[model samples]
Every structure is written in structure tokens, then in C-alpha cells.
Target: MTSNGTSIPVTADGIPRPGGAGSLAGRTVSRIGYGAMQLERLRTDRAAAVALVRRAVELGVDHFDTAQFYGDGFVNEVLREALAATRDAVVVTKVGATPDPGGPLPLRLAQRPEELRASVEDNLRSLGTDRLAVVNLRRADTGPGLRAEGDQVVGLDDQLAVLTALRDQGSIGAIGLSSVTADGLRRALPAGIVCVQNSYSLVSRDDEDLLRLCTDEGIAWVPYFPLGGAFPGMPKVSDEPAVHAAAREIGGTPAQVGLAWLLHHAPNVLLIPGTADAGHLADNLAAGGLAPDGEGLAALDAVPSRSADDVRLG
Candidate 1:
């Protein structure tokens, strides 16, 4: 059924296939969603990027993860155009950093209370929507990205207060967080967070406690870098021998197996694996069907988390 209770066709939920249904932002979304970070690579070919996003929707991708700083708004612009003709897609975007196209990291902290608000508005303007579906406040308290500096440092409660007010005023739909710690999530729980975007993967279990916390609270755990390999020294699931063995056992690619393990690991987990290429996008969505057998799961489970990647997957 669609959100309004109309019966939907099998094509409407293609990749999720009904059995793969999951919840996010208080709505039903396909278990496998599309992330837009990699869209940055397609900035020069706007038409192809827009087509990829629409193609994702055609393939039943209802949940979308994006950030304003992505491609310094180029990615968001691609989404704005791609989504203009669609309806009822859960478009989630993150703030707390602005793009520095020429910088080494390509982003700078924009985490002050007002800076957060500005980023949300920038997203709205770029997406051409009055209200954002969800606005994830990316904090610098943890790793995998830039950290907050002197004045950029702001209290979590203060940040939530602003986002909460936006929800009340109808500027955004719900609240979310990225690159946050367990304690930070706990402190912001009262504000009604609908999902979390920490860096987690099969080879990175440092945030297992936080994943459990979200599951217990019924909050969605939308992990970034679900396959690992986001940064150097971070353990990539592709590099783990156990993951390879599990992939062979399950008859799926190592990347697909890594994603399958996440879905199997927790019910609240929603994958937003991003890809610029059509083939990779298909593989990501198809991961929804790659269930690991008990032996596969155990082999994957026994693989230890690398402490070095603990440097980031907070």
C-alpha cells in the first residue's frame, strides 16, 4: 500500500519486494535506500546524475540520503531536479559543514546553532522544497570527517533546540544525527530523532553499542560507509577474508554480503549505499535479497573489528 492506503503495484516497491520493507522518518521505506554522496562524481554530467536518481525511484528507492555540502550543493541540486517529478520520497539531508571545493577535505565545520539553520535553508533552496523531509545534524564530536574548532563548538541541546523549533514551525519534518557518539545521541533523544547516520560496517563494530541503543529505542540506524573503506586505515569489508567466505557461501558479491550482514544484524538498520554508476546501484538494491545463512552469519560475526577503524566509525 502507498502512504495514502492505495494498493501499489509490484513495480512500486521493486527492490524492496514487500518482504524487505523497513521504517524511517515514521514512514515505510524500502529496506535498501540510495545514498547520494557518490553523485558528486557525476557533477559534470548533470543529466546522467539526474537520470540515476530517477532510475533509483523507478527501482523503488523511497528513502534518499543527501547532504547540502555534497559537491558543495551540486549533489543536492541534482536531487532537486531528479525528485521534482516524483512524490512521497523520504529525502533526508545532513548539515554541520559547508563545502570547500578547493580544500584538501572539501568541507569545513558549520556546526553552530545558526550555521545549522543556514545549511537547512540552503538545502531547502537547493531542493526547492518548503520543508525538508529530515535534517541530520552532523556533529564533529566523532571522527571519519572534520572536527569542530573553537567557536564552531556548540552544545548538543542548543543544536536540538533549533532543529526542534524548525520542526514545530514546519521548516523540516524530523531530526537526525550523523558522525555522532552514543552519549551525544542519548542527550538528544528527547528531541525526537527518527534516525542515526554513524559510520558502521561488518568490519567496523565499534558502534555496536550505539546500534543496539537505536534498535532498543526503535530509532532507525542509517549507517554511512556501510562497506567501510571511507578513509585510510579504516578496515574495509572488501578486505576481510571472512566476508569473502561469507559472500561465496551466500552467492553474492563481497560488497553485497557485507550489506546483507547489516540488514541481518539489526531490524532497525536501513542501508543507503550510494553509487554513481547504474550497475553498482542495482547491486546495492539487490543486496536486500542476499540473506546470509547461519554459517555465513557466524563467519561474518566472528570477524573482529579493527581498532584502527575505531579511529572513525563512531
Candidate 2:
């Protein structure tokens, strides 16, 4: 059964339809990858978390997005245990943020070269890997955190220097950027940006231009909050009337329709929708197989756009 409580359909060969594949930093990965953010918030036991990761791999999901800041390394620990033997998995993690020890829910930006190096070491230690598949430098000045007066942030070059050094040292495979603007991308591209992870969905198209830029440059656009974050007052893609109507028409769930729209929206898009529930994972992966018609695409495109601040995370 899927997240919407529908029976999963298989092809005539009895094989479950796999998610489509896309290239990220020269590596081919399933467009429908798993995100580890939800694992940080899951109240379930460790076994359950590990099981979910294994299940995702079993379902042919190769790309997994995670960060050391998530659950103060709890999520990466879970991934370490789960993916220990899964050599084919592509783990993408980020730097530039750490949980503030004094606060219950505040993150401190650690963008300095020294801090970034330490964070990278922590991620490697926690995930039990020598080299990460991709390391996205989370721009603290942009997105939902502190706003920068200028397009460029201080110490960005130094941070990229650290990442480039790591890549040269074989500690990481590819470099990326997160929560960055088009100008930010322009600055970081010279340092070798292979992907851009930003907030984007049917209701949040603030990164539309950046997405195009990524496409033009052959960089993968990995969208966070692809279904819109579940924070209060934030728009939910599944709740959109157009999504619901399209779901009905296609015999799928609203979430499935939203994800389908994203895949259809761009070839460079690589989805990493996070979910702790097995059922939801199945639904998200199945969405990659959906081919939305022109009508469905039109409806999805017509959804109102929300402010970038509304969907960005600190």
C-alpha cells in the first residue's frame, strides 16, 4: 500500500516501477532520492530508522541527503548503521550549521574554513565514510536565516577553498550549494558547484530562475521541501485543490502529483523528499513513474507562489 492507502501497481513483469534516474556530479542517481531530515525528528526507535534507510535502498533509491546538524548527528548515525553495507548508496551531506548547545532549537552557522573542516570531519566520522559523495555548503546569509545586505557572503571564498582542498584530498567527491541565490551560485560556480539544493515547490517558485541557471549549466537542482514544509501557516502542496483534482484524475495521491510535477518541471531536478514512514517513501518513489498530462501540468503551474522566507529553514 502507498501513503494514500492505495495498492501499489506493478508492471507486467511483476517489477515495481522504479523512480527515474538523473545525473548528479557525473554520478547517475534515481531522481526520487531519500532525505534524512525527517529522520532527525522521528520519535521512533533506531531500528525503525535503520529499516527505513534499508527499505529505500531496496526500492532502488541511490541518493540520500543528510546533514550533521540534523538531530545533532543522530540522523547521520542512523544512516551509518543502515547503509554500512550498501556500497551503492550516494550520501550527500552539508556543512555551515551546528546545533546551538545552549538552545533547544537554534542552529549556529559555522562557515569559517576551520569550522567547516571540523564539520566535514564530524560528518565523515558520524557517517562512517572516508569520502562523502557530495558536500553542499549551506549559505547562512540566504534563505530563512540571517539575511545578507549583499549578494555575496563574507568568507564564501575561504569556505569554498576548504571544500576544494577536501575534494583534492579525496575527502569528498563533489561540491554543492544550498539555500543560495542565483548570484550566490555565480560566485560559487567558479569553485566548482555540481548541484544546487534550494527550497522549491508548486507553491514556492522563488528559485525558478536559479533552477533555469542550473539547467543551463548542467548542474543538478535538488529541491528541499519539494512538498512544502509542514510548518504552521505554510502552504501544503498536497492540500492544493489543483493537486487534489489531478490526483483523482491520475488515481494517485496529492503528494504523488506534486512530486510528479517537479520531475516534469525539469530534467536536472533530483528529488530527495524525506519521510520516516515506509508507506510515504513508497508513495514518493512511485511519483517518479507518473507522467502528468498537459492539463495536470497547467493546474500545477497555476498554483500561487509563496514568499521564499515562508518556506526557507534556518
Candidate 3:
């Protein structure tokens, strides 16, 4: 039943699998896709990161997420090299904020109409693609937590108008929002919102309400921090008893159970677990078939939910 030799079982469609399809691009992506944020030298060694991405494809991960801010272009380049020959893989990249050319930096907003167009062109060039599959407009906020409700500096209407124009011009396939609030999503949903990439994980469920909104509106709720906030000291995958217990019962790994929980919780939920290890990459794709029902789902739901992490960049 597995397609592409990855652990993900094939659905009726010829694609590898199917997740929640709230938008056009997500609808096009296979379920159990890979997220490529951590596959860069900024966080880990470059060689290992590149291997992780190539291994993800070998394991049948057809959806890859990236942002221009990730290593300021390093992550996207890694993805281009990884899946350039894969026939069905989809790449989702972000626009709006571009980081400075160095370490531990702050994000600067870069989404004036012309800048927005140029950013898309830059992403296409850096990723070595003709057109982007999905383009999310990231908001840069000066806040302490991951989901801060700061004053609206970049008018949401203006941003959506630009995205709509790009979509019309076929520069990108679909549009999404990242690091945004429920109110912010409500404002942008009218302009063909496809997905909302917020910081949600077993530890961080502050955006549960937004997840519900995505479900109600038929949009994919793509959780960025599926394991935890992206930090070295973040809790180990085995720390969540629900994940560990599920893994013990299903004969899979804790990381797989963590991702499976997200998959089983909501059909509209899409997970993008990032890694820097090739073996971990293949192991992650295997988790998709470790179906957890009844007590397993209940156990995952019982895990204590923490407030939004203090990390600003999600």
C-alpha cells in the first residue's frame, strides 16, 4: 500500500498521500510532506543537512516548506538540490521578511509591491525553480512570544492584494500566512487564503482556535513547531509520554508518533517536521502509517499544553 517506497500509504490518488487540503498548493502536495527549515548550516552542518533533504525524498516526502529568511537562502538551495529530479514534490517558500546576511539576526520587512515581486523572483532563482508552488507572506514583529498581537504595521489588505496579483500572474500557485494571529487570518482569508503556518505543537497549542478556523474554512493548518519550539534545548521527542507510549505500542519511534498524532488529530492539519539527519528523515516518513486511534488519540490529547514559547521567530 505504500507509494514511492516511503512509509506513507498511498491514497486513491496517484500522489504519495493526502493531508488536509485547505488550499490549492496544499491540496496539490502529498500528505506527510517534509519541512526543510532546519536543513541549513546556520543551525547544523551543511553536509548533514543536505543529506537529510535527499533522504526525505527517498522516503516519499513530496511537500517541502521553506522561507527566504531561513539561513537567508541556504535552506531553499538545499531543497532545490534535494528534490530537483523528483517528479511530484512541491516546494512552499515565504516572502515579506528578509534577514540580514549573518547570525542571530532580526528580520526586516521587505514587502512593498515591487519588493514583493522581486522577492518571488529571487526565491525562484535561488531555489532554481520556474515558479513557486506556495508563497507565504511572513510578518516580522518586534515581540517576545511566538504569536504576538502587535500593532498592524504592514496592512493586511495591502499584502493580500499583492499576493492575489502574483497568483494571477502565475508567479506562485497559492498564498499563505505565517506567524499571524486569528484576527490577522480573519482579515486575510477573503483573498483566497490556502494555508496558515502558525507555531503549533504538542507543547504550544495557543493557536488551537486558529486551527479550528482553518478546519471550518477548509484551509490547511500547517503547524511549524510540530515537535517543539525550534531550539537546541527543546524537549526531546521521547519526553511526551503520549508519543513514547504510542511508539512503544506501534513499534515505531517517538518522533513518528508525534507526527502521527498531528495527522490523526485533524484531517486539516499538516505537519512539517524538520531535521538534519538522513536516518531521521526516513524514520519521520515512516510515522505516517502508524495509525493511532481511540486511546492513542486520547492520550495525545491529554498531553499538557504549554503557552506560546518566548521565541519570536517561528
Best by TM-score: 1
Going through the candidates in order, what is the number of backbone clashes in each?
Answer: 0, 0, 1
Worst ten in a row by lDDT for model 2: 1-10
Candidate 3 RMSD to the correct structure:
4.4
- Lowest lDDT sum, 10 consecutive residues, model 1, at 1-10
The TM-score of predicted model 3 comes to 0.82
The prediction achieving the highest lDDT against the true structure is: 1
Give the runs in model 2 whose Cα sits over 4 Å from its true position: 1-17, 42-44, 101-106, 145-153, 310-314
Scored against the true structure, residue 96 in model 1 reaches a CA lDDT of: 87
State candidate 2's TM-score: 0.89
Sort by TM-score, best first: 1, 2, 3
Candidate 3 Cα deviation (angstroms), residue 278: 0.8
Q: Give the number of colliding residue pairs in candidate 2.
A: 0
Q: Judged by lDDT relative to the true structure, which candidate is superior, 2 or 3?
A: 2
lDDT of 1 by residue, 14-130 (tens): 443322778888888887888999999998899999999999988888888998889988998999999887767889998888987666577888878899889989999988899
Better of 1 and 2 by TM-score: 1
Clashing pairs in 3: 22-219
